[model samples]
Target: MTQPPPPPNQPPGPPPGGFGAPQDPPPGGFGAPTPPPQQPPAQPPYGYPQQPQQPQYGYPQQEQPQQYGGYPAQPQQEQPPQYGYPNQPQQPVQPPYGYPTQPQYPQVPHQPVPGAPGGGRKLSAQLQIVIAAVVAVALLIGGGLWYANSGGGDEEPNAKGSSGAATGGGEDGGAGGLGGGGKEKVPADTKAKLAFQLPVPTVPDVTDVSGSWITDKAYVKTGVNSVVGYDLDKGSALWTLPLTGQVCGASRHMTADFKVPILFEATKRVAPRYFQPCTEVGLLDLTTGKLVWQTSITGGTAGDKKVSFSEVTLHGQTVAAGGLDGGAAFDLANGNPRWKPQANAGDCEDLGYGGGEGGLVAVRKCGSYDDPTVTVQNLDPLTGRPVSQYKMPPGVDFAAVVSTKPLVVAADVNDAADDGSGVSDFFSIDEKTGKLKAKITADSKRYAPRCRSTRVEGCTQVLVGNGRLYLPTEEHDGSTGEYGDETNEIVAFDLANGRMVPEKTDAGDRYTLIPLRMDGGNLIAYKWPPYDKGGQVVSIDGGTMKSTLLMENPSDKTTRTAETSFSSIGAEFRYGGGRLFIADTLISKTKASTSLYDKKYLAVAFSTAG
Candidate 1:
């Protein structure tokens, strides 16, 4: 089918004010992402790789541009991949097939953070300006597109329901999925450029993102109605489908070996009855923005309902969905049910299913303080048959699933008494046989996800904006079966065991550690604390754990009584223009005094940056 050529004007043509080309690709080379359908860890879905910015390791250190001084200082001269040279992502390994799909980050209760009793020295005026510059540029550039996409012109979104294109979200829903949601509908004709709008009506949270930077294509999830994908270079909607809800997207994309889009969606719905629907998967064709398929399991929002989750691949296919018994799998091409393991009902827990030269691996768990059943089963992605299953020690239960190199890990969770004291355990199980490969746990207090020892449930699966697998853990307590407190620490571990980087944060209730790409290899971490307190977005120094604060609360320096919670961020390509889309947390309705957190109601495009 010959498609309509893009309009006369398009992006990748010239920069605003015809500035120099986005120079500073990383030192080695551009993180070249191959064409179509690949693996996990979706990353910067567009542009050339910027210069490399090494993150500091253990202690707090200052970030020096000299460390990434390899690339030429010029921003122009960036080009596409060469045919003969094999361009692999300079980051994490390839993701699985049949990727996850969603719009906004799901609303899960995060860890509680206490306001730090102490205060650090206020930053100097010079430091504040530098930090403000990045954000200001981001806001200024992104805001323009956000306005144009936000239906400044009447758009018939619900009418041409399947077709999509919006202004990138502004401070409202500043990212991709943020602009598209269950809110008021927009007209179909209100087409804005890449920085214009996100595909989803709300912003999907940003999780585990990693990939080579290239302007080939990117993916986005709008409201429950559909998921839209686009070509990164041109910034246009490839396809759109009516799947509905705020969806969450993965950071790392599958490698080019597989002929599929690296992006997908997963949505969670909050009903009036306090019935939070289970999570369901959504897949989109990156170029066409078409809804290729959705999960078809019973009880799941889109058939697969799950709280904790994991996904694995086998024989070029991907499986790892939640079910009444456990997570299920489907063929990537046609959403075919590949396998269905017996239903146990603990919590369908997290999943890790992958098939490679070694063998197929699948892990599933079900249990908690109330749902009692701790079974970790390893199976074949192609056969859906279990080769082994491990019983979580009686003291602990499995929280969410995490992906490790040679194994699939579950941040072991300890059952808690009514008093709220929990235990912790960490184990890296063989992805092939489901056997316990390695287990780490602290003998003292429970291992908390926020601690340096306890592994954050899905940390391994998290892809820093750069292409790498960053697993964050605290400590694991397998004995007493309780999780630790936030006082421990947060660290980004190199899955390959090359180096363990412990990143620090000022936020007390730090939960997840988010990584974003700014320029070349330069990466920044967005630490979202659990409570109403604002978090920090830090620039890391590869050699030291030292961080440079890029942004902080401008007005609300001290934690205010207002319950402000940040939501997830989504990564999507901005079509027909020079922009990347994202879903961000503008403001939430939570009240701090109540000790309550509100689920994300909407996501907006906060700003735009290269």
Candidate 2:
């Protein structure tokens, strides 16, 4: 038989609350009663006297209901308006047309008797009422089952032609709890025990996207040419220092030993060629939130534009800073001039990186961007003079500094002309002799260049720490001379010998690992959700390669929606004073009311304390 169509949409009625089973076969149709089966009288054992003959049995066992197909079909007969009861066995074929019909028995009310309404019980008016009540209960139960199996009242129609319950995202449309709203599931070990998170300060001109954390405070650059120190644990501003110069810039650095200096630079805010003749540098006493000492030194030549100070390293007792014009080293405690390294004539610019054993690295470009002749020099922190110098591979350009102390790690520009082939590498140089100690392996494939990553506000793909280098890259095929798939693999290489170390083979790929920093001998990183992949904080033991996933990315439904685009704000992740800070910036397709800043930023902090 054809099945019936489904019912139309309608507000559901009350829930079903009854129980029932299929009704028995209809009345009368039970079947013709069978005559009783004849049984021969038992003959006594041969010696016993024969028993007197017994009368024939009156009723034959009702012939087993005639089987139709596999399942038993209900007997055909009139159905009762309420509970349908099956027919009872008929009396023996009316013993030859009324041989004085066997005395008929009277039916009892509300009692079980054979072949009576409701199985021998006569249907008195009260009985009918009881049957109706039972039927009503059955209907109620069936209705309740229907309501439950259908979509409940909580769901809304999904835009994609389906439906889902509202996830109850938070203010930013991100789920509030750790694993709520379909966010990446947090591994048991690395789930965050948050210490605190401060409201991101609204700054007009944010000079630095990353924050520098000291004992209990973090220093950040504001838009209005100022640097502010905030209590990292309490989310309160401690102090603010304004830079008074034309093209001013500020940076904060904390050394391994906890020495911190707040560095500032600018040109005269005044007239002709408002040039930055000097950079004002100071060391701050974190506990008192006071500047221990401050001074300005004239090193690089002043010009029409502002002096750009790029790398700021706090090594031992020295503060090394460099800009377009030149670089300088100063006493960290008293701010006394150490040595000023000047750019030679025809040199494009001078840059500095932290050198091993408390030294410094200066990359001087002697050739223009087209010709590109670069020299790497290891400088003494105290003297600011070259301890050792070497030229980079012929046509290769200089990339960013990966490490400064104990061993200097730097990447060569990945352009075709630089390597003359498809390979790109990061080199570990011996600081004493400025010689290549090893050509570190970066990326996954042994022969391919590293993955060229777009600078995200807070994302860094390559990390140098302890004695190893961590690089995130896509697998490449050497024979084809082409990159393969998109599964980004993070490879760790020994800085000592530049050999790739084996990762735990049995640990199956969990999340995309991108190296972020080295903290307390642990390699800190952010993992992409294995399920819905993106930024998640994780820490890997540098030695074992074991990974632990920390805070998951806030549930961001928009990332999967067509209404918004995925982008990173390029805010650098920061780890210091036993805490990890993550900054995230995303743009929305929906418009918003006027605000001081065009966009908002999320700053989350995680702690290692028990």
Candidate 3:
């Protein structure tokens, strides 16, 4: 049978909600008045299983109705002006104590004195001296107040003083120190400084450039039909490996030695047949900048057609590729066939596989096309056999594997999530027994983890490590009370019982913190840049939940603009060895109307080392 045509690619557009856009604060708004703090609600134990009140296993009904998820219900009131923009209707109020106040002067109408020569009366020298002294005193007081309130006369807030850092270690496999186990080196100073930036390569049209990785010696990134390794500190190209066709899929995880699996087309894209089947699989060695091996397989009823794949992953010594053509596995070292697709009972098909340090898990589909049953299976890496499997609840036609080891899967059950994010619930299962351990309902409007609806491993902003699931809460009003200034925080839920952990790491005012990946037991996170600030990278200790500032990008106008060019939704972020690399997954041709200020970047790097 001939393989199906590839899916059409959507044109890229600006990210929604005006994220990273600057807005003026409302007049006289220094910050919103701080509200009295309330005691936090009691948290359930990690191991105690709590039944959800709602009928669905993953979506629990909340006691209070909220305008958005994870936020408290508010009394009906007029909608506030958009963040970063001024509100004209708001009346000016008296300034707070210690704030500079305009000196008040009596508004007495000027009257010509009978003995005066002009329209205004003249004052004696003594009276003039008194007026000068009062004016001078007011200026002195106002200047002092302004200096104190403006961050001690500094333009930027000091990173060290503004944020708290984790010291020593905590229980439950706490991330001991920066670059845990000395596998990655920590800079003497964690304040991030600009290292270098790579200009976006000129593409004839819109192109896909989706892969990136970090190593001790280089930062590797995929370009237009090529992969380039750059010096970790200098941003200069160390090596470049060109390919015949465009890269279609790349594994998120790499082998211990830095070899990665990637899927590409058999030939370069040409007219009429713009997209070729992504059939070729290859292992790329980052250290040597070479393709160690490349191979393709034949499948279908006749066993003579080349199998096409939409995704690929590596687990131990096996590299697995899967798609509508079914799934196949090969030896990672020699590209030898390990297992080929076979007819399954009940018309079941292996859609894709998720592989990592933990193990390899496959998302299997069964039943008719209209009504499908999806199952998560823990497969033996060497021999393609399921050791254990957990059947998903009915109506879950698709599932994204968040993690393979602890077996965390995300799904949109019965079209309830509604949000395009493709997630409404998370299931934690016991891999050994294929039993459901816990189910946590995530409200689509409240949480911000995103996954591709059809891809098994295409998940981002959600991380599973140290027995917990970490996700970012939707951006909300910051306490500073400045209109248009929004922020968010990362909260963790216990994997054992689906109960939320009490501790959370705030993104601070105007910054949005997103989980990048795990570093040992620590969570590496990227702080999305606000209009006036540069992006930041920090390490959040898994045990204590304190954040140690890792890399702080430059806040200058040009640097800030460049750093934020990559949208958070589709960009790839990698942090290690005291550096942060941000790269765009797709690049399109610049339109004639595009302004010079609207510069595009292929990748940007920042480091804390000199």
Among all candidates shown, the one with the greatest lDDT: 3
Ranking by lDDT: 3, 2, 1
lDDT of each: 0.32, 0.41, 0.67
lDDT of 2 by residue, 106-195 (tens): 122254658876586656767666775564444322211000111111222121211111111111211122111222223545433455
Q: Kindly list the per-residue Cα lDDT of model 3 for residues 1-610, writing each as its tens digit.
A: 1111111121232123211112233333234222213322222221112223323222111111212112222111111112321111111233321112332322222345576776578566576667756854553332211100100111222111111111112114222332232134446876787788888887667778889999879999998788999999999999999898999899998987899999988888876546778889999999999999999988642258888888999999989988887788889989987766655334556789999888988887767889886777777777665666666766689899999988899998778677788888788877775655557767766678998887899999999887778888778778776876788878766565454544567888899989988877778889997898888888887655788777777888888888888898899998887888899998886454275458888898888866
lDDT of 1 by residue, 177-295 (tens): 22111111222322222233222233233322221123245534343434444444344655555554443333233324322322223444444442233345544454454556666
**Model 1 residue 28 lDDT score:** 26
Compute each candidate's TM-score over C-alphas.
0.41, 0.53, 0.71
Considering summed lDDT, which 10 consecutive residues are worst modelled in model 1?
144-153
Give the candidates in order of TM-score, highest first.
Answer: 3, 2, 1
Clashes of each: 158, 24, 7
Best-matching candidate per TM-score: 3
Stretches of model 1 off by over 4 angstroms after superposition: 1-215, 229-239, 244-282, 294-315, 341-361, 365-373, 387-389, 416-423, 432-437, 442-524, 527-610
